[model samples]
Target: MKTESQLNIIFVPYLSPGHLNPMIDTARLFARHGVSVTIITTPANASTFQKAIDTDMNCGYNIRTQLVPFPTAQLGLPDGAENLKDGTSPEMLGKISYGMSMLKDPIELLFHDLQPDCLVTDLLYPWTVESAAKLGIPRLYYFSSSYFASCARHFIHEHKPHERLVSDTQKFSIPGLPHDIEMTTLQLEQWVRTKDEITDFMNAAYESESRSYGSLYNSFHELERDYEHLYKSTKGIKCWSVGPASSWANKSNEEKANRGHKEELAQEPQWLNWLNSKQNESVLYVNFGSLTRLSHAQIVEIAHGLENSGHSFIWVVRKKDENENGDRFLQEFEQRIKESNKGCIIWNWAPQLQILEHPATGGIVTHCGWNSILESVCAGLPMVTWPMFAEQFYNEKLLVDVLKIGVSVGAKENKFWASEGVDAVVGREKVSKAVVELMGKEESSEMRMRVRKLGDASKKSIDEGGTSYNNLMHLLDELKSLKASKALEKTNLKI
Candidate 1:
């Protein structure tokens, strides 16, 4: 058997923050367990988490990142516009995607050159499955979301339940899932509704998972035990659930504060002090992951809802062009909230993990993105789920229905960030009502107790002799064994 030091693995994380951050944390966790780890990404993407990697290196972990030049000039994009968050327009978004596609050849060449024992890559890069096979190494597919979402999607794809629906608004139950989950065709991605370029691309990625060595989830057993079992038994694949990965990797407050992006609008102390003044479980933390873009009307509704709810909140507002009519209104609203000290508006990035961990932060108004849901669960906070797109609607089902740890904001339709229009907006009444019920109702305490138990389980699952810890050890052993068997096959061919 190869020692942990001898086993080398390369991680290829997608350029977006939600995908990139957790994969980097998982890579660092592998390094801590004595594996030699290398992450390959474009320079702009590397900058997001290089500080965390440098800290691990300084602590004597064998982890480092290799930078690939981004095709900014070729794609006609700005120098640092390599991440999904950087795509401000449809044209820019296409360019960033094309830029990512342009890297496949060079990245595959690196795979051949590095000769690592295994490759762990994001679900977006289906091409890496073939590259890993060519190198005679196992490729582990890193799924940044939950098992429940995966299982829900699987059943939806398998049964074509949405195909039988008469209209996009009609609800259909996904067949063969562990729980009775209902979704409308509108909640599915645009690709799922019709076969297009993206449908083909996503299909290839999901097919690649079945062809890979196995899959890894950023979830624990207790969180989705039934769905995990259903996923494995139905798919008939080897998998591991080693998660709450962010919590496992970023233990210190300093690490949590600086987890993802390097730039921050205000220093950590500024927000920390704001939270300190609030009572325990008094403030609502509102952030729609990195990708969701709200229209001006939606923003106004949110502002009014929070104000009407009569609750304290800290909302992270993404920096965008202020040419819209709502900009002046937002400025006036910000001024009013600032004077009242009822709300705090942070422009651009906020230290999400640290804010979630703060005692004074009571609940979250989330986009139902898996990472945000996991982080909120770790903080033992119930959610006001407002899923925008992707697998988020599926995740919301897990939170609101299966887990009973969240209250839905009555969002009925699903729309991508760029395509969000007046048709998709949830009015102020729903928003205010959900927030009030989540933070003030008697049932809120029961939800908090249930979520706090899950939070405790998340911590225990990553500790020594825990499920996730053992799963990591077993995965390492399996990788070593696979490497050894490949070596023997080559020796036999020579003989």
Candidate 2:
């Protein structure tokens, strides 16, 4: 191999936690392998993952953060409110999307100075493909989702089956996918249907992905063999499948050193202690994820539903949704649960990984975010899917219809916090039944076994000589080969 300096790669992430956190872990993985990595973010969003990045810094990794200001004032958003979580309506969320485009200049300037060997950016930043071209470096699209969802979207995009349907409710076969998947027009996320700015931006994003060097997925071949191959054949873009990357990077070495580290370990959340006392596979864990906001009525139904199911549970309730009706219902329920020791409620945040790994935790009632799906699968727990909005509905379909590892609460409406009011309320009866069936039935045991096999595969993929590990090694070797050729060409030009 021709002599060359170490390769440097820059990772640029979107503002949401779900998108940003996984990319951070991917960056850390690169650093661990002796690549210099820089993560691009707005100062406000940087704080979200900086602590984890700092941990690697302390551990002697070459990961660093580079900041580009999020255009808060230009978008008329309040100072420091740059992320999707801070937006209360679609209008403001739109502005946040607009702000991302304005970041192109600052990012391009940084690229000139760093002259990285490659650029890896989230799918939203369509401009990065050109940014990489300007510096004569390669760019790769980073999809912070499953290959199943991306493949589904690609088929829908090409076929336009939703366009010819009689009504939004009519179900049509997703054309050109390996699996026989059926989906209704309404289940498609809002962005796919419209002719608006967001739609235009995404169209451009897909175009950029098609033109880029390749795409990177946070998934592995063992988990989605057919879809991964289908994605490559359909898109014609080279891909690298190195994942369960989130858990692989974030898994605590300290805990691994003591695999038997009990729930009562020093500084463990008190919730874990409560979980440890419960019988094996006897508790239901519920959370709507970080960005979703439920109406007071919806919240009340879920509260009563969990109570009616008569199963032990721990629910993570958002502090933002509490009201007189919901607060009153939860308070009354909490007292009864305390007396009976049937449940626990955490008002804002819960330590998700620890709880999911606990032996007492049985099933999850989830928002079906891709990150959450991977985490749950890695824990070998089946889910009760309640998809709120965005691509989550598609994710739910993957779980309930394709994988058969989940039961649906049948999300009747796609409500985002960016909307004015609730679209539909899944009543207590439906919620209760789904929870009961998931936790108390033989089918649930079968699903748990199915998911546990996937979980084992997930763990193996990142281990030495596994599919994901080998893919990662091949990727690095190719990049090194490319670097050697570039260095030799420069030397010849000088001569």
Candidate 3:
């Protein structure tokens, strides 16, 4: 184990809102618990951090942020670089390499100057781990993902190296993963295939994780008990599940629009007003998360599916092109919606947290990213999971099969590569049936109650004396112990 030291914890993330949000919240929680924390992010994200700091400052937190220089290649990324139209594994590898190379020196200098007792960072950026090791800081991986997703990523790293590319048969079932959880080749990211770069990156990723001697996952152990054993046994690092972290991080003051960029970027009231008119558990909030995009055909298919389902819904469609004719497709969609006399509220820019928090939100049609999953769970809503790529398939499996908290879609066919922007079509009949089952059926109602109970437990865990809260305290004390040990070591060395 790394020796005790005063925890001057430094956290860094690869550029993305999803990665940045939870991490910033965790930092705040640490600061609240009396750990001196500094967040290193790009200038692009500094504003978001500033708002959060202001909010915390008002509530009396000392969490600080420093805008590190962004690597030149990272500066001009499209709105969603992770979901780029021309994304390839090789290209992503080069981008990550370049980003790390740019971030390392500045980060190392800061590590030396700040002299943090420990370092916590996102799993994707291996360079941070290398930097932490060089500085002799105890590094912890804060995976902003479910236990299932983490397990799958680990499985992908351990096996599938020589295979180069994942075949459909190859992902059927792994020896180490949970039963009935299917991971297909198409759902696997390109990072899984590149032998040299991916392996090297993953080795560093694991090494950093190993050095941490512990991890903080954004999930509860009860929800993932089966997989938790494997997680513990494999890494040999203490795993602390402290989530639905997103909800714990939520400011709860919808009135305070000054805390984050989401407030400026979205109109929370518009979503809430529509929800107010709807019945309890009557509306389904549809979104594919920030990183997933749909093609025209898939969009039409989803439109028709919602229309046929005869349910009211608030659909969030994030387009790369929000030009004058941005919502040109809505004209056709409205006609179909009018025929059914069902409600369809389309927002290119939707207030996700506010919408999820609304009482009318009974179900979520989601991309099963960890944040979206945690948000849905916190909202006490069930999911109609449409996992796109990467570790989402694993998250989807946990939701639908293991936890029975959501309905699963998107793995039966390989529509991801069929065309650009085209979602794998789950035709109107299947979509209608699934929604009907999720919204009106007895089975669906039971699942709704199940997730509600889970939500309550999540809240309890993060509240005073709850599992998550207690875990956070333990982690803080652990850092303190390290701090004391370091002081003692220096004293003995002088003797």
Reference-based TM-score of each model = 0.97, 0.93, 0.87
Tens-digit lDDT track of model 2 for 70-138:
889877999878778777666888898778778888988999988899999999888889888888878
The TM-score that candidate 1 achieves is: 0.97
Model 3: CA > 4 A from native: 1-6, 72-97, 156-171, 193-200, 255-268, 321-326, 334-341, 412-418, 421-423
Which candidate, 1 or 2, has the higher lDDT?
A: 1
lDDT of 1: 0.89
lDDT of 3 by residue, 1-495 (tens): 122343678887656656767888788778777666789876656765577677677776667787775554444544333222223334563564466566777877888887888888887766666677777656778888877777777776677532553464455554477575656666666566434686576667766777665788878755677787888998788978777666787756552333335346455455566678788788888887655556566666777788778888878765552333436776667666655546655554565777777778889888777888887887788998877766677788788878898887544433333254334566667777777778885768789889998888877878889878887888888877876887788899999
The lowest-lDDT stretch of 10 consecutive residues in candidate 1 is 262-271
Ranking by TM-score: 1, 2, 3
Candidate 3 has which clashing residue pairs, if any?
A: 4-482, 4-483, 5-482, 5-483, 6-483, 8-117, 294-421, 295-421, 295-422
User: On a 0 to 100 scale, what is the lDDT of residue 473 in model 1?
Assistant: 97
Tell me the TM-score of model 3.
Answer: 0.87
Native-to-model Cα distance after best TM-score fit, residue 156 in candidate 1, in Å: 1.0
Q: Which residue runs does candidate 1 get wrong by more than 4 Å?
A: 1-5, 264-268, 418-420, 489-495
